[model samples]
Structures are given as C-alpha cells and as structure tokens.
Target: MPTALITGATAGIGAAFARRLAADGFSLVLVSRDETRLAEAAERLKQKYGVAVDVLPADLATDDGLERVEARLREGVDCLVNNAGFGHPGHFLEVPLEDEVRMLKVHCEAVLRFTLAALPGMRARGRGAVINVASVAAFFTRGTYSASKAWVVNFSESTAAEVGDPKIRIMALCPGFVRTEFHQRASMDVSGIPGFLWLQADAVVNEAMRDLALGRTVSIPDPRYKAIVAVGRLIPRGLTHRISAMIGRK
Candidate 1:
C-alpha cells in the first residue's frame, strides 16, 4: 500500500482526506496540532480501514514543529497533502502582527519547507503526488490569507511544470466555501451567508483525489468555483481587488 502524509488531519477537510485515503487503502501519517484529535482520528482510521496510521502532533507555525515533520518527509512519502493553515477574519491592520506572522509561517513557510523536503525522495523514487489545499481566495486579494494561498497556487503550478517530465504530480486543490470548521475557527462572520453556497468536506476531497489520480496540476473542487476563477482571470485586477475588499468586509 502507498503511504500518504496529510498535515492538519485532525478535523475538517484534512480529516476528510484522512478517512477517504484510508478507505482507498493508503497507510497514513497524520499531522496536526491537536494531539487528542489526531490520536482519535488515527484510531478511527486504523479500526475502520485496517491500515497503519501514525500521528504526529506538531504546530506548523513554529520551526521546531516543522522540523519534526521535515524529519518524517526524509523517510519518503508517496502522497503529500499540505493542508495545515488558518486565517484571522478581519482587516489585516486590525489583526495582531504576531498572528499575521504566525499565519504566514503556517500557511506559506511550512508548506514550502515540507514540499522541498519531500520532493527529492519522491523524485528519486519516480512516483509521487502532492496535493496542496489552497482556496478560491487565491485569485483575490482578501488579505494576508489570500496572499499566502496565492503562493501555494503558484508554487504548485511551477513545481508541477518543473517535475512533470519525471511523472511526479503536484496539484493545488482549490475549493470555495467548504463546510468545515474553517470559518468557525477563523471566527468569520457568516451571518448573511446561505447554506446552499457551501460544499461539504468529503465532496471536495473526493474530487481532489480523483483529479490527482488523473494527473491534473490544479484541481478546483467545485465547477462553480472553476467558473468563478475563469471569470476572475478575465477581470481587471483593480476591479478584482475592490470586489474582494468589499467581500472581506462582510
């Protein structure tokens, strides 16, 4: 069985990926900051799928935490899902500088470092898949969150191009309004948002995994979101930023 490593595997989309991959017969290495939740998820997967599961509890915002995960990457990972990230739902200036810096570390630095650490082993093995969980916000300037995710989008695209010849696949999985603890954890105000706008975690992950298997470089989970991105690319950046800022204020 192939070994799959997923960061932020305690809840939401990350947890969904864990369960789906386990069901697909992938032995898992699950990473998250919540030790209790990680252990519970590991136990559940082991029991349900009869697959080996390893839990690595580490906060991705700190170098020490990332180093621990980097050590595991050296062992070689068949599928790497860089899914650990969070955002503060407020104007960038109003958010604490410390929190902003930590967000950058967790969302950008950790993903970059882990990908670099894992790539060599995968490349040498001549088979690997990297699935980065970015967001539709990547196309808009929603704040620091969107900026960081944009880095993920570009990184995955560039890396995929560079390594495509070797049959190594790097994909960015972009989803919109995923019904995960994401917004709740970010403390986003969604008072006016309708229920039908949200995509479930499992649905997003299922599509992402399918696209990865098909060697797609970028996987936008929702067709609606894909259309939105397509339209976004056609619009002027100034207009896009204006609309994004208005949306951010909501």
Candidate 2:
C-alpha cells in the first residue's frame, strides 16, 4: 500500500484526512506537535483501519522541529500533506512580532521546505500527490493569515505548471470557515456568523482528496466559497480590502 505523510494530523482537517486515507487503504505517518494526541490519533486510526500508522511529534514553527520532519521526507513517502498551520486574529500591528514570525515559519517556511524536500523523490518516481491545506482566506486580504494562504495557493499553482507533464501532482485545498478547533484556538471572534455557514472538516477533506485524485491544481471545498472567490476576483482590490476589514471586525 502507498504511504501518506500528513502534518497537523492530530486534529481538524488533518485528522479528517487521516481517517479518510486510512479508509482508502493507505498506511500513514502522522505529524503534529502534541505527542499524546498524536499517539492517540495514530492508535485509533490503526485500530479502526487496520493499517500501520506512525506518529511524529514536532512543532513546525521551530527549525529543529522542521528538520525532524524533513529528515522523514527524505525517506521517500508516496504522498505528502502539508496541513500544519494556524492563525492569530488582530490588526497586524497589534499582533506580537514573535507570533507572526512563528506563523511564518509554520505556515510558510515549513511548508516550502517539506515540499522542496519531498519533490525530488516524487519527481524521480513520476507518481505522487501533494496537498497543501490553504484557506478561502487566500481570496481576501484579511491579515497575515490570508497572505500566507495566498502564498500556498501560488506555490501549488506554480509547482503544477512546472511539472504539468509529470505524474507529480501539487494541489492547494482552500476551504472556508471549517468547523474545527481553528476559531477557538486562534481566539477569533465569530459571534455574528451563523453555524450553517461553516463547512464540516470531513466534508472539506473529502472534497479536497477527490479533487486531488482528479489531478486538480486547486480545490476550494464549498460551492459558496467558490462563488465568493469568483466574485472576489471581479471586485476591485480596494473594495475587497475594505470588505475584508469589515468581516475581520465581526
């Protein structure tokens, strides 16, 4: 069976992906910062799916942490899911410099490094898939979070273009307001939003995986979100920024 390496596999979309892939008969290597949770997740998946599961605990924000994951990537995994990321809510100026730097490391540097490290082996094999968990926030200039997601989007698109003829597939999965620990962990205020507007984690992961299998370069999970992105492109940048700022306050 093919093996999949997934970061942030302890919770949210990452965890959902783990379950889905396990059910599809893939063995797994799960990466996350929480050792206990990681072990628990791995154990559950292994027991539930009868597939081998390995837990790798590392903070993608730190160099040592990223190096640990990179070392594993060199082992020639078949699929890589760069799903580790988090966000902090506030005006850019109000957010601490350290937090922003850490976000950059986790959301940007770690992703780029892992993809780079894994690409050589994937290219050599001529058959592999990479999924970067981005966000519909990439369509808006909400904050540094959205900016980082935009980077993921462009990176995946560029990679697809660079290796279009090869079987190496790179895709960005962009889902809006996923029903996960994301809001609570980020301390983001979502008081005004209705619960129905949020997409479930499993649904998002399922759609993304389907799209990846179909060789789509980018997959936005919700139809509403796809419409939002479509409308966003037609609007002027200034208007988009203003709308984003308004939503950020809610």
Off by over 4 Å in 1: 248-250
Candidate 2 displacement at residue 172 in angstroms: 0.7
Q: Tens-digit lDDT track for model 2 on 125-173?
A: 8888889998998989977889999999999999889878458889999
lDDT of 1 at 227: 89
C-alpha TM-score for every candidate:
0.96, 0.96
Name the lDDT of candidate 2.
0.89
lDDT at 133, model 2? 90
Q: After superposition, how far is residue 132 of candidate 2 from its true place, in Å?
A: 0.5
- Candidate 1, lDDT over the whole model: 0.89
Q: All candidates' lDDT scores?
A: 0.89, 0.89
Off by over 4 Å in 2: 248-250
Candidate 1: residue 22 Cα off by (Å)? 0.4
